[model samples]
Target: MPVAIPLTTHDLNSGGFAAARARTTARMTATVMDLTREIPNIRAYALRTWHEATQRLAEDPEATTAIRAERDRF
Candidate 1:
């Protein structure tokens, strides 16, 4: 997917298209790297929360009824 950015004439005049493109690319690369670094942590958090939720449901006798009621509300 491509995104459009609105730049002023002055911005274009100062550094031109190449400079602007390089800057945008660098920022995007850094953002992707940051998210990549957090993959393991995010996965661990998701798994922990999922386990806790399932455990709670297992302990609650009325979990099925509650889930059905909640689903009907939507």
Candidate 2:
């Protein structure tokens, strides 16, 4: 995510630009950190959903039959 900070000539001359840059950098860093912290949970959810789908395909006889029928049609 890009943040647009509007800077005036006075802000640049008076050194306010540096402070604004630091603040924006800190905010972006914190947002990235927060997203990184959720990686494990996100991975777990994805894996769990994949496993459930696999299990369902394995256990459902109708689905197995349908897949085999489709394959034989080729």
Candidate 3:
């Protein structure tokens, strides 16, 4: 679907509508594609952070104990 643009009758008659539609479509497509590319990197960062924390807590008795104690405070 083409992106919606506010156009007057004069603008439509002057072919400005086509130009505006094209620009809007291109901008929207670029934005969606950029987000598609970035989402995996975002997910990877979250997973990496989770794994690092998990490993640290597993390997450090004091950190594990502190985390458990903190959780118990709730």
Candidate 4:
């Protein structure tokens, strides 16, 4: 995931530190809640799917050959 670009708020600059802090804190809470959910994360599902596809191709000679030929030209 792409992280948000943080705005610098040095003491010398008149930036809205309070608003920035509040926004960051709120986003952190929301992200943490999402992390705790049981739904499959992006990595896990992708790994599982990749493994299944690989195993299928390995077991089937035709598929394995076709995939190899496609990748050879890819």
Candidate 5:
């Protein structure tokens, strides 16, 4: 006689897998947003540095003329 197999042991619930995937997607989205949040701050700092350098160059005419002469060489 052949042995009988139990079907209850093969129960596969897909709902658990879907829930786990949704949680993972949400966490990854949050992480990506957090990582890019500093972009604006970095841009602001660069812009401030550029403005200060421009002001300093404007205050010194000799440096500005030298920069212009060098710029025309390219």
Candidate 6:
């Protein structure tokens, strides 16, 4: 089966913005495509957190902040 590529839509209210909006929409589409490639890894990290650590973090916010800081560098 052939996979479908996602397309982002843009709407312009005034003709004055037609040129700028096109450039912006192109940049947005490219960024979205790049970010989407990391969805699986992001999902895995989110799930792994709740496995049990979520409860511990709920038990304490300080430790959670430290862990979050480390993850930000990851």
Candidate 2 global Cα RMSD: 10.2
Give the per-residue lDDT of model 3 (tens digit) for 1-74. Answer: 99999867886756767788899999999999999999999888777766666665667757866466444432
Q: Write the per-residue lDDT of candidate 5 for residues 1-74, one digit (tens) a residue.
A: 99987645234335666678789999999998987998899888777766666666667757966456444432
lDDT of 2 by residue, 1-74 (tens): 89999977876856767788889999999999999999999989777766666666567757965556444433
Q: Rate residue 5 of model 1 by lDDT.
A: 84
lDDT of each: 0.74, 0.74, 0.74, 0.68, 0.69, 0.69
Candidate 5 residue pairs in clash (backbone atoms < 3 Å): none
Ranked by lDDT, top first = 3, 2, 1, 6, 5, 4
Clashes of each: 0, 0, 0, 0, 0, 0
* TM-score against truth, every candidate: 0.65, 0.58, 0.52, 0.41, 0.41, 0.44
Model 1, runs deviating above 4 Å: 1-15, 64-74
Would you give me the overall lDDT of model 3? Answer: 0.74
Q: What's model 2's overall lDDT?
A: 0.74
TM-score of model 1 relative to the true fold? 0.65
Ten-residue region with minimum lDDT total, candidate 2:
65-74
Q: What is the Cα-based TM-score of model 3?
A: 0.52
lDDT of 1 by residue, 9-73 (tens): 87776756768888999999999999999999998977776666666656774888645544443
The local distance difference test score of model 6 is 0.69
lDDT of 6 by residue, 1-74 (tens): 89987643443455647777788999999999988998999889777765446555556768967467445534
